[model samples]
Target: MNITSTLVTCVDNWLQNLYTKMYSHHTETYENTVEVHVQETSSPLTKTLVLRILINEEHKQVHIPNIFIPLNFHRQGIGFGLIKEILKVANVYRYELFIVDMTPSFYDRLLNRNAQPAGYDAVRIDTTTRL
Candidate 1:
């Protein structure tokens, strides 16, 4: 993978439009919603979105509701890169990170990889785990 060509950006109006077009069924919105997108610059004229994560920053907490990476792009470190970027943001803001509705194994893998920034941890909340 060409890491130099990969770009991580926060959501804006243009991104919101693209996200809505891609995920029409996810209609719920939050006031503090933050989207982080991982795009690969395949060519000078084309940028492909390989991964996207929706996080809600509220009450000094960061809640990740969803993470999407195309099947073809899995295991390519795109998702990990996106999470690292989000971790940087969370570290700066000192927000407690929570992964909601995602498989616990994923969080475990991240933890095993030492992905969490210093003084910050990712909490997994789902049916199988309690707060």
Candidate 2:
């Protein structure tokens, strides 16, 4: 299978476990879901997950709850590419984007960088929010 499908399979398994753990104590059923987006290399031989982001869409808001990039992929432009893609979609749909649980240092680094991608300035960090 391609890297995207592989990543989705892996994430689905992880999410199942997470759901069980999170709702084990609750007697009521809850729908815990998020859209998973993966960024990976095009090469089949060296296919790697550059980044994975979870988006929770609600009403007119889009919440990015998690973004994971392997240590080896750090410093690459993959994160910016993913964010740009999300921004395009959000703009098209007129949705507000909120990044949740991002570290201040990371946010600072992204903003402080001189060569930020287009729409980088539009990103809003919601450190106190959870989705």
Write candidate 2's Cα lDDT for 9-95 as tens digits. Answer: 444444343234231211111232334433233335433332334434455555555566545555665455455555545555566
lDDT of 1 by residue, 1-131 (tens): 11111212332322353444343222223344543443333343333433334444345555665667655556765555555555555555565555555466766665565444222345533222321
Candidate 2 residue runs with Cα over 4 Å from true position: 1-32, 35-58, 111-131
TM-score of 2: 0.46
The global Cα lDDT (0 to 1) of model 2 is 0.43
Model 1: ten consecutive residues of lowest lDDT: 1-10
Candidate whose lDDT is highest: 1
Q: Ten residues in a row with the worst lDDT in model 2? A: 21-30
What's the TM-score of every candidate structure? 0.48, 0.46
lDDT of each: 0.44, 0.43
| Global CA lDDT computed for model 1 | 0.44
Clashes of each: 0, 0
